[model samples]
Target: MTLTLSHIKKTFNGFTALDDVTLTAPQNQTTVILGPSGSGKSTLLRCANLLEKPDSGTLTIDEESIGFPARLSAGQIRKIRALSSMVFQSFNLFPNLSVIDNITLGPVRVNGQSKQEAQDAAKSLLDKVGLADKADAYPLQLSGGQQQRVAIARALAMNPRYLLFDEPTSALDPELEHEVTKVMAALSAEDASLVVVTHNLRFARKTADKIVFLEHGNIRFDGPADAFFDSDDPRIRQFLSIYDD
Candidate 1:
């Protein structure tokens, strides 16, 4: 089982964001996408989740394949989206709703789980993410880390086949970021199928099973995490130099 993007290309107006990018994220492994800013890392992740449809490409999740630049019905779109859950850099929680309500909304509404069932699942996810006691609190009441944890829990409540995180801790300080990254590390250890886009080298080194590095809308390297870090390629070496302490 895998999520595969074949010969994917995307452009905005006159600028190319991704050019003939082909990648496959296998099940039960953490695939980390790394690149400098505006190197098409986020765009690639968005395309995989169908948030930004590729101008030309085919996205295949397991056995089902959807080719872009073709009309897709609402149900078809929903089916594609249901295969994965995404947590954005910003915690996109509903401020008006309580934490528990926010987590349960998707399962209860989209997945058609009963309210009680959704709540039970949400609570279990909350406990797993160390937010069990804050279920009744509002998003505004939580810190950046807490809110992001809630977002992670919200994503998990869907029981998606893949979890996509786009710079999940980019908005927090180091201490707060650790709180969220700890949860992610635990998930990676559990062998959850994860695709993460981040500049956090430490987390990538520790958690990534595979690494795909992009540069100027092209893939610079795709290999095991150890090989990526130990690469002799000048582009990758320069990129890694920036994060070297």
Candidate 2:
């Protein structure tokens, strides 16, 4: 059971965003993607989620595999996408909806869960993320951290096999970032399959089972987290130096 991207490439306006990137995120492990700005970390994650159609590659999620740049039906896309859920750096919640509603919408609308079932699960997820009391509040009423937590809960409601995060805490201050990271830590402890793109070395060191380092749209290193942090490669060392206090 894994999410595999094989020889994936993506470009935008004649600029390459990913170059022959092949990565396999195994089930029940955290794979942290680290790179400098424009390293294609977010682009790779987005490709895995099928938000951007790859110029070329094959995406396989467990038993289902689809080659990109091929004409795909809406049902085909949805079937493949249902295997994973993503939380972006910005909390993309519906402002008009209450917190509980935001979390339940996906499960009810897309996943076809009954409203009661979705709401029941949403309440449990909200409590798990430490936002139970904010259920009736609107997204605009919450702090950034709280909004992000709600985003996490919303992602979880889908019951996806893989949870993809694209710099999930980059918009928050340190204190608010900690609030979201705590929930992520708990999920990691439970051995949820996660692929996270971030510059947060501390969280990566503590939570990542594997680390994939990218540069200039190509993978530079892919290995165990410990090996990545302890690497002697000049590029890896140079990147790590920035996070060194």
Span of 10 residues, lowest total lDDT, candidate 1: 62-71
Residues 102-200, model 1: lDDT tens digits: 999999889999999999999999999999999899999999999999999999999889999999999999999999999999999999999999999
Tens-place lDDT digits, model 2, residues 1-245: 99999999999999999999999998999999999999999999998988888999999997889897889889988887789999999999999999999998889989999999999999999999998899999999999999999999999999999999999999999999999999998999999999999999999999999999999999999999999999999989988999753
State the number of backbone clashes in model 2: 0
**Clashing residue pairs in candidate 2 (N, C-alpha, C atoms within 3 angstroms):** none
lDDT of residue 121 for candidate 1: 94
Please list the C-alpha lDDT of all candidates, in the order they appear. 0.94, 0.94
- Model 1 spans > 4 angstroms off: none
CA RMSD of all predictions = 0.7, 0.8
